[model samples]
Target: MPTSKETSKTATFGVKNIGGINSTEISISPGVTVLTGKNATNRTSFLQAIMAVMGSDRASLKADADEGHVKLDLGDETYTRTLTQAGDTVRAEGDPYLDDPEVADLFAFLLETNEARQAVARGDDLREIIMRPVDTDSIKREIRRLEERKDDIDAELSTIESRQRDLTDLEQRRNSLREEIGEKREELAAKEEEIDQSSRDIEEGRKEQEQFEQKLKELQSTRSSLESIRNKIESQEASISSLKQERNQIQNEIDELPEVPAGDRDQIDAEIDQLRSERQALNSEISNLQSLIQYNEQRLEEEDYEIAQTLAEDTEGGPSDTVTDQLLDDDEGIVCWTCGSNVDRKQIEDTVSRLQDLRRDKAQKRSELKSKIDDIKSEKRAIEEKRNRRQQATRRLEKVEAELDERDSKITALKQERKELTETVETLETEVKELESEDFEGILSLHKEANQLEFEIDSLESDLESVTQEIEEIEELVAQEDTLRDQREQVEDELADKRTKIDQIEADSVEEFNEHMDAILEILEYGNLERIWIERVEKSVREGRKKVERTKFELHIVRTTENGAAYEDTIDHLSESEREVTGLIFALAGYLVHDLHRGVPFMLLDSLEAIDSDRIATLTDYFSDYVEYLVVALLPEDAQALDDSFDRVTSI
Candidate 1:
């Protein structure tokens, strides 16, 4: 049991003779609560009653019962919906809690739609249907999918770019290696004759060349190691510098943020909510009054026209005195045929005056309504502005709070990173400094030894070159040239192949239809046509916006213009009529751009006059992509548009 105040806050429900349900009453909690029962135990029936209270006509009486009733108690108000098989209609009475007609549509798309239910039952993600990035979540999802594909292409392009860079570096290294090998071979050839001049000299020169080669390898290795260490030291120093800069920036940002204080958020929210409810009530009243005024004006116009026409006909047929006599004799009084009301001669005489007075009264009432609406609007506006001010303050405070949190987190991260970098920089700098100081003497000694070895080698090579020119045979040089040609051919082939691959990768950038050529084949992945989102990615360009030749479209989807062809695509898979309908959707999307978050549009078609009935079903399905409420006056027998894809089909 709850206190009266707490009890009155809950919604209660009662159901009787609905489907297999007999009589049951339940107090629904404020939040999500489940009702468990075995199949065939009226669980669905009870649930249907709850849906009914929200304006879903999903309930019917049991076959044996003549009538069914669902009663809902929302706080202090109660509403009842009576279901009768005789009339095949749901008649709602009392306070159904739904004063606004708009709310009735809320649960309709979710609760009553079997397709939607099946989709959910299959465990499909509902975000695609619920997100407001666009009125149609499908469109947004399609765009997201297109982005994924574009990213995949970009990944491939990145690989190609990286490979190209590698190829360029390899090509340069290959050229340098060939140059070094060629120079060494030329020097050896030049010394060949001198080596043949004496066996002792030849043997001594061979030993000297071997030793020089060994020392050269050692020197090269030492240099490479030194360079590696220096690069590491430099990299650490750069990282430390960057860390310090970033830390300073973050600290500055943290210092700039203002401190925030607590506010009376709950009270402010309550006031705003109360003001909004009052405004909603005022809006409903104003809408009702406007509707009444419109209806009254139309009725008056029709009444006056009919009365004038009837009076003319009556006057032409009979005298005024005779007509008056006939009216007096009648029990129902003068049958004012025009207005369909009882009126005497006096009433007829004052007909214009009466209409004028009634119009004046209605106009005055409308003015008063407008004035009242203005007052309510002013009040609501003031409340909203204050609420917005508070909300802005709250947002600013939250932003500052979040910034502070981020600042703390980032500061901690920066401090740890800075410490690690500082340690690394210190260690590398010490090693580099010690190595530099200690290696100066060793490097100088090695340089002197290297110069002496080079002087001896040069003298030996010079003597060998002169002797070789005089006595060496051409056969050896010819054989060496052949070997070098084969090696050069092999190197050239590798370099050429790499260059070709790089070119191929660059060419892959222009493959406009490579990924999207199969979009039409892929479009058949989802549902029948009543509601759908069609996506087409025509082409994607990876390059930044520049003066480059690329396909005009990046991502394209089905589009329609009003009564126009549906596609701007060069490759349209749908038929001409389909494209036309799709074009109409584009037109609708453009027209309803302002009301995108309001859900689907309301469209009226005067029989879709130019369209043929053979493609009505297709059009119906296509229309669902754009229109929520479509009023198309078409001959059903001819149309047959209400196919199995449609949820409900009614004929009059």
Candidate 2:
């Protein structure tokens, strides 16, 4: 069960030309405040004034006034609202207590035409009213986002696990490279010692030997340069191959993207704009028709003396009797207030009724147009998404192609340099061979062995350096394993909660309604009434030629006969008082279920004349327990049965 928060602030309302009230001011405390008055004494109008300042557009402007204002002072804050007649509809301005008052209007404002109260009386779908505040589409979108995040996390964890499996092999390869480099250094030192001893032995031809050694050194340098060029060529080839593969993949993705015809989006946008314009025009026409109908109906019912006299004087060559008589006589034609032409009362009424029908028809047409516009907008969004994906793929493909071209050009240059270096090495080797007389051959062999040993050592050291860096990177990734797992667990829990949110709301609403209905029936003590409860049932419904299963709120009524026998009954058998009580209880259920009391402190009630004064007082008292401020409008006789301790306002 939900409980209302308590407050001690007093609410003061200042009103001018709103609803049926011309102007009024009232202040009520944060408890039960009863407005006691006869009909047309601005009791309901005062309630409307409170609603206007509370951020609701349902309040009406005075028929005779062009503007209205409502100001509310609660605690230390003052909120004001201005209503001005704008052609056909009332335009509201200024700040209010709430930015959006949808929940308040549906649940907290318990006026005569409240949807929750009327749904029960009309036997409409109760589940739809209870779940109106929950946005199922938004919930589904959130679920999709969470699921995508979880998928990404899973993929990252998989990569981390795979890298952990390679850790041991990398360590072993790094150790091997270090040992080979150490052995190669020792061999190079021994070969250098041999070269020094051999060079001393060739002291007799020392100059020739020195010249031959220099040529051999040039040949070794040329060979090293040639090897470097070959290695570069190999690397460039690998890079070019990888880039080509990537370019192909991106091209395939672009090819697979959904095809959206050219200019389709622009055409759809133009259509949606045209439809919106038509709908707006229809709305304006509907508002004008409604205002005209309301003004004319009020004039006819109240019989304004000034309007009647004007119409009487305008009737030329007709009865010159009293204006009241002329207006009252059904057989005589009176001047039309709108067109300034003689017209029968019945004929004018028929025209008004026809106008009302036209308004309804236009309203329905506007609704259909709105739905169509939404469909077209959705289509345009889908087309835009496809176009974006294709554009991204095309950009990636172009980048990969450019990179491949650069790599190919580098490989060509490297091959040409290698060809020139190879020729230079051959020429250097020929010169060294020619300088090699049979006298200093041993010294030359020692030098060549030393050069080979040094190259091997350098290669081994480079391999060792690369292996060590990879080991460090793998260790870093392994450190984050625990943190990634924890995040995955948290996401899984959140996903589960979001998935079942709607189901929980539906169950809670049913339970709340049933429990409260039983308690209220006991308190009211209707002799034959046994119980009135709502059951959540599952059934298949037809939706656009498809049968889908849905959950519905089923209302049940039970009554006991005079012979002490209980039987099930339909809602049609319920009396007016019983129906009214049931409807109010349903509204109360929604209020608690939606937790409206936490935000909207004030609850307004009116038009409870169907229920007796005693029951009405009990209902009011029951409702007061759930809200900080409870305001009810009742007649003088009905107000007598309420608690004397409650604050009462007899005049506006």
Candidate with maximal lDDT: 2
- TM-score, per-candidate, Cα-based: 0.23, 0.85
lDDT of 1 at 144: 49
Minimal lDDT window, size 10, model 2: 1-10
lDDT per residue, candidate 2, 381-496, as tens digits?
A: 77888899999998899889888888888999999999999999889878988898777677767777887776777667767877888889888888888888899899889889
Task: Give per-candidate clash totals.
Answer: 10, 0
Worst 10 residues of 1 by lDDT: 107-116
Best candidate according to TM-score: 2
Query: What stretches of model 1 exceed 4 Å from their correct place?
Result: 1-231, 242-279, 286-652
Candidate 1's residue-wise lDDT over 1-652, tens digit each?
A: 1122423245667888765567878765432222332223444455556555544443445545777788877556566777655443334444443344232232122221222222232333222222212222233334444555545545554554555445545545545545554565565554543333432333343434454434444554444344344444544555556655655655555445433222444455555566566656554444344333322322332233334445645666744655555544554344454565556544543554454345445544544444454445545555565656655655655555565565556556655655665565456544433443231334334443444444445444544554444323333443354555555455455545544542332233223122222232244221222222333223444666644433221223443556644655331444444333433333233223323224222233322324455455544554454444443434445345445434221311
